[model samples]
Target chain A: MELNLKLNLDASTLKADFPLLGREVNGKPIVYLDSAATSQKPQSVLDAMDDYYRSINANVHRGAYYIADLATTAMEETRSKVQRFIGAASPREIILTKNATEAINLVAHSWGREYLSEGDVIVTTIMEHHANIVPWHILCADRGTRLRWLNLNVNGNLKLDDLDETLDGARLVVLSAMSNVLGAIPPIRQIADAAHEKGAVVVLDGAQFVPHLPTDVAELGADFLAFSGHKMCGPTGIGVLWGREDLLEAMPPFLGGGEMILDVTTEGFLPNDLPWKFEAGTPPIAEAIGLGAAVDYLADIGMPAIREHDRKLTAYALRTLPGRFGDKLNIHGPADTSERGGVLSFTFGDIHAHDISQVLDGEAVCVRAGHHCAKPLMDTLGVTATARASVYLYNDESDIDALADALERVGDFFG
Target chain B: MPALEDLYREIVLDHYRNPRNRGELPCPPAKRAKGFNPLCGDEVIVFVEVDEGGRISDVRIDGQGCSISQAAASMMSVSVKGKTLSEARELERAFKTMMVIEGGGSPSSPADLGDLAALQGVKKFPVRIKCATLCWNTLSEGLTTE
Candidate 1:
């Protein structure tokens, strides 16, 4: 027997904590199902930001004064926390970034684009977000290398057998651990092993995976991993790129500035060591503290429990939607929760995704629509765009009910 | 079978399935252009054969996308075939304006929209606007550069 998941948010807690969830869209309580886009911040993360600003607002890394020292300590604390959260080998392995886009870009521009020789093959999958795909394409374009892809299975899962075909000449394999649209969680550990066997390093796009699933950089066997804080219940404009210590030591710093250098002179340039080499100028001190607090908040509940909650929610959505709408609904990903994460991308009767999204908005049931930055996957799925309802821990079965009800209304409107 | 009105006007389904003038013409001494909506995986190749006095002798399109894109392309081919280049450009602009807004009704009069009017409901689909305008954007591009 399953306990009914309750969305009866404590009014005081909601008002005191989020303060934004109290917002009414179209005169209805907003039921956000677009966690894949980004997540809602908790009160702890917000308070951490406030605490940083109020108490220890100063530049980090090169500071000498008390406040600066505090900021530096907070910054390094976050590095350690992040390193532990992702199971990185060392705190110096985590490089602070602007976003996941920039994290992938650092690898492209710093490692592959600058380091790899011309004509080298870069292997990726059709399921990658444009963040992962475009950077590699740009790198390939600049370096005169070839960028190839492994196609997805009928259920939208990446076919790892294709890796043998793809990894022949590949110097690097970029894999998105979980797709934002299809919600298919690829066998990243297996793919990493294959890439490693082929002497190709694997980079995991953990933007979608890290927030929803339990991850270990070592256990997964990824050489590099990138994720954004906003998607993981933290502040915006902050991301982390964790690499193996040896890899970070070998790759050149992406950005050159005051902080990321050993010494500055008119004669020549000498780069700084490990993580600091890549960090560059003034880092986001307060945001990093907020992210650290967010990690603490998430860890308190444990990711395994959260993943379990989403698994049940996704299974509920898939099973109930077809029963209610029958032939009117078309789910785009795997039929079971075993292979997929928590996304329920679909079409309702004759209602287009855009039309359905708007009607769902009218009912305060929000979801993402369009290609979702995975155009190749969209083409493979034979849909130009789809309305995607992805569940996180905050989302419950009631959220599913709201979405199903609104989808029915959209069907009535367009069917 | 469901009624035509229940799904779409019978003409819409007809256009979507057996699209008219669906193949592209070579850049035959005339203007041609391409357009794509990377967000939706839509690509359009438009070729316009202009007769003397800026009149369109034929306008053909080639592309692959969802039903909205394909049907809109088919409708656009017929809409501009006999019209002047200026008329086609105006229809392109009008079609674009209609697709951006959700639930904005068609051009009020059937004669006002002509064949392109069938896509008026595309306005309700904001994400599908790219799909609806794939052909029109290519036509606009052709009108300007080619």
Candidate 2:
């Protein structure tokens, strides 16, 4: 809540930072709680992207021309920046892709699809979004590998004790650092250690993790990590998949195209190198430059400060909402916010989540409703869907207040 | 805040509180169809018991849904009960006309709808369109089997 004052810039100044946020929706400023879907971009990121195309837009690594050289250099520079951002030891570990979904599919298609074979097990959890679930299903069925899952507790935390029991003979562990619906933070460090003892490489779907908390790949002990750019105040169509250098080097190329090839022959085409081998065809150049700007923007604020700010928002909502709505409101996820992000998925009596979202929309408060791409988790929660108000760096106490006020509207709407 | 009466109009609340024909009919005698709204997991199983006249004699619907959906189903089953196939189809066509984008997509005026006009307030909330149309689709799907 302290950071509310820190971000207390004038209306025009805030609009200057985010031009899109200035646009009125339903005759009011958009509160934009759908950051969990994708974050709004800062003007700095848009300007950075514009600067790239206007000055140095060209095909990467294909020409001797200066424009191409400039483009290629800026493109590769983002790789190093992302590597440092996640605390990976080398730039070679970061592979650029369209989004976290693509980054995950790359690993499943290239590395997991091949290395895994009959009876080899890949461990996951019911809490994963379908992006994490279906890919492994395809990989396992094709490769004859077995896909396993860790269960959820009544409070929605990953049942790690059950996870330990499932680890026997497991070759890979795929999990989200945070539950997308419940806002439960699984013990990544502990899960990684358990998987390591079992000789399994751990892969984290950090799409929910990287945006909320400070992420250090080495500290978390993940062999492969994937996250999208748009969740972290960057452009869509850009993401980073950080793997151990050895794994990427050994994994076959996911997509074969001009940017990723060393040479072509009637016999076969050889790959260029580690990062490029994963990225194929015309890359999202503007998005990557925008990602670099986003990295700069986040780093300037410092991750710990952002983490603490959201912790306060989550904690405050936990303390406040139950009293106001009483039995009419049921908050999903845990009561504690120290172990979670500011994703509050809740329901007002028997009101459907879409109706709750619509009522909120009328108040200029934007929250996400429906399954949030985590249907299995929704099943576990015993609700078809929930209305979720998620927060990011730009959100503050007033935003949370707006959310609470909107819920009162929802309660009346269904009365 | 708006008055509670303005938000939930008495009829909407009445349908929610006491939904009609709310339980399922046995599948063997009743022709049933399953409808799922992928946007949300609002699933409905509509069962129509057809008599020798080849008309819907007893339309019993079963499902779990949000208020709009459950109410719509509650309203729909009663509206079409014992109607001729032509009448039932007319209601379905009229419901779909209000729910989905119109053919060549002209916006629907409330005057075009009658008793179903109670649902026009729901049109303002685009997100709830699927909820308002769940039973209509179930009716559409169930009619095919009958």
Candidate 3:
């Protein structure tokens, strides 16, 4: 008989493990609904980072001392954890960078400069965060490449009706797995298949997607997959870029410095092996270990349960916000909860998003208000800004209720 | 410090709902300059028509933004209309003084900030202070531009 011994986890049990969750804001307990921005770290992640500094504090892969060896082992161990976390083929495919922004820049500078040239086409979606869109824009502007945009449908999902034509003669297709604004998870496999059929490489921005969903890079058919650790209950300084072994081997070093080199002479230098070649300088050592602990924590809770929790919270918000405010509250994105993640971006009546956020702040309700680093999506949505509330595993129905009650105050305050 | 009622004083909300001098003024004497709060994406356009003696004969504030910003602009337009450019500049300085406070605490000023005094509550909300200042900055920019 097979043994199943995973702990049955939910918000109440897991909420106690995070230190910040216990704190109060304005006399009321803080209802943290901004996980999409950055997740709250568990005690395990914090302890792991502190332990690394206390016991195994040393530079990695350089010093031959005992602590150096232990530090090196710990750092490299995080790489393997990350590879397994996302179901990448091997640790060699994972390149640890400063953050997702640096990861995208790595691909843009290394692969883009080598393969792309003037007049080549790069197709991207309008729903992308500036991180995914801006790098390609710089590449296009510099190389004189032509960039095409994939528009969104009326429901805020990508309108790939023109994918076949748009992918024609395209060199690369860059897009997000899930929109940070709309919370819509685009059909990544379908998009990857289409891009592959048109002989274009696919770069998937998984910053928002990987946190709430189970990511299998090889199965997703992405040549490059990027995500940040901070968004997934890890520290802010580290992020991952997973690439096909062949593609990574073909690309040049993103930043040339100490760790990324095998041998450096007065005249020239040879790059280091697979992942290290991309990780040029002193890496985010403690942060990587913390991310490894976060990966372990998530694995313990199980991604499926987390997904279910997120879905519940999202559905609750979707159902509650509409029922409470009717047409007065305009929540953007897909109507079906299954089609989207937990992010809810919306406007309440004629009140500006900043004002709504201010009123919400009074009730200790945390929601993000701005263009969400998605100006193109803002233009498409016909609004300059929206107040966004996103949920994670630790968020429960009570948090959603708090949000609803606070929103009522926002409406009344404006009225 | 995080009180909503303090920030949303009735006078401020009144100005937001029914702003004074809120449309475009006829040109020839009107000078318009735009201001933008890139973080909130709040925008304001300040138009001022100066008299022969460098006094503002008419002023109009137009834009889309939060209550604090729109109301600040509305109240600002009301205060500066028919005032000399130098007097308007003084009001702008006093308003800036009122908005800047240390550690989200209130700022003390011996001189009255006039109608713009209603916006001193914004000092408690540091993030919204930029929204409060967008109009005054635009008015300053408009006066200096020709």
Q: List the global CA lDDT of all models.
A: 0.80, 0.81, 0.89
A1-415: candidate 3 lDDT, tens digit per residue: 1122443447988899899999888888989999989999999999999999999999998999999999999999999988887888899999998788889999999999999999999999999999998898899888988889999888779998888998999999999999999999888899999999989999999999898887788779889999999999999999999999999998989898999999999999999999899987889899999999998888777777777778877988899879988999999999887789999999889889989888888888899998999999999899989999999988898999999999989867786
Of models 2 and 3, which has the larger lDDT? 3
For candidate 3, the clash count comes to 0
Q: Please state the CAPRI-style docking class of candidate 1.
A: incorrect
What lDDT score is found at residue A135 in candidate 2? Answer: 93
Q: Rank the candidates by lDDT, best first.
A: 3, 2, 1
What's the TM-score of every candidate structure?
0.83, 0.93, 0.96
User: Sorted by TM-score, highest first, which candidate order results?
Assistant: 3, 2, 1
List iRMS for all predictions: 8.4, 4.2, 1.1
Higher-ranked by TM-score: 1 or 3: 3
lDDT of 2 by residue, A4-26 (tens): 21432232344457777777776
Best by DockQ: 3
Q: For candidate 2, what TM-score does chain B get against the true chain B?
A: 0.82
lDDT of 1: 0.80
Q: Residue pairs in steric clash, candidate 3?
A: none
Query: Which digits, one per residue and each the tens of the lDDT, describe model 1 over residues A1-415?
Result: 1222342332233333565666787778888898899888888999999999999998887668999999899888988988888888889899999889999999999888556878898899888898999888887778888888898777778877667878997889898988888888887888888888899988989999999887888888999999999998899989999988888898888988888999888997789988889989898888899899988877766777777778888999888989998887888777768778888788776455765676687788889877898777777777777888987767777778988888767655455
Q: Which stretches of candidate 3 lie over 4 Å from their true place?
A: A1-8, B26-28, B101-111
lDDT of 1 by residue, B76-140 (tens): 88888889877877776666656644335544345766767676665554556677777877787
- Which 10-residue span in candidate 3 chain A carries the lowest summed lDDT? A1-10
DockQ of 1: 0.21
